[model samples]
Each structure stands twice: as structure tokens, then as C-alpha cells.
Target: MYLLGLGLVLLLMKYLEVDPVATWSWWVVLAPFAAAAAWWAWADATGYTKRRAMEKMELKKKQRIDKQRESLGLKPGKRR
Candidate 1:
């Protein structure tokens, strides 16, 4: 995400002819986007993406359960 943001900023700077960035090659300005793509590919291949998504779902589920329990005057379950 940081790489993507950097790539966009560099692109804008280059487009606006902002000093050193304007003098840099398009490849240099665009490298962060390529890096971001590589990072995403690597994350997907390593199951990191899936694990994060599953964790998010689990958190949401636990929160929903806790909210229900609270509404019924019950205590929230202990965290693992």
C-alpha cells in the first residue's frame, strides 16, 4: 500500500515536472508500482492474504457474539 501510494505520488510529481522527479526516468518513477505488484503476488502465494482475511472474519464473528451476549445481560466470553 505504501509502495502504491509512493508510485502515485511520484507519477504525479513527474507529470507536473517537479524538479528531480521530472528528470527521472519513467521506469524509476514507476518502480514502486512494480514492487507493490510483486509484494501482492508473494503475499498471495504464501497464504498471508487468506490468513488475514480469515482473522478478520473471526474477529467480526466474535464481536457480533459479544454484542449479542451483552444485550442479553451476559458477560463477553474470554479471549483466547
Candidate 2:
């Protein structure tokens, strides 16, 4: 998506016969930093990374429970 935006920007500059280096100096300087910050903000806001971490933790917990049940010679879904 960012690449698409950059391609469009370049195409527009070409079509307009503008010196992109001059016209887009600020963008060149700022776009990458802005993109990185936006990505970080979105990740933080959506808690996607946090959710993944939680999922891993849950899986580990389930594995440990299964191991304990096996050690007890008990089958899952059976009340003892």
C-alpha cells in the first residue's frame, strides 16, 4: 500500500513534468518516518502484537495442562 502510494506520487510528478526531487523533498525526508510511526501507532492501538503474545501464552498453558493430565494417567474430558 505504501509502495502504491509512492508509485502514484511519482507518476503524478512525472505526468505533471515536475522535478520530484525538488517538489517532494519534504516527503522524501518525512514519509518513511511517518510511515514507521503510523505502523507503530496502529500496532499499539489494535493490540495485535499483544493478542498474539496472549495466544502463545494460552497455548503454552494448554500444553502444560495436557502434560499434567498425561502424568496423572488421565484422559482428557474425563472427570476423575
- Give the per-residue lDDT of model 2 (tens digit) for 1-80: 57456756665665576874445655664465567677768878999779989999999998888889989998854665
Q: Which residues of candidate 1, in runs, are more than 4 Å off?
A: 78-80
Best by TM-score: 1
> lDDT per model, in order?
0.97, 0.71
> TM-score for each prediction?
0.89, 0.48
How much is 22 displaced in model 1, in angstroms?
A: 0.9
The 10-residue segment with the lowest total lDDT in model 2: 20-29
Residue 71, model 1: Cα distance from true site in angstroms: 0.8
TM-score of candidate 2 against the unseen true structure = 0.48
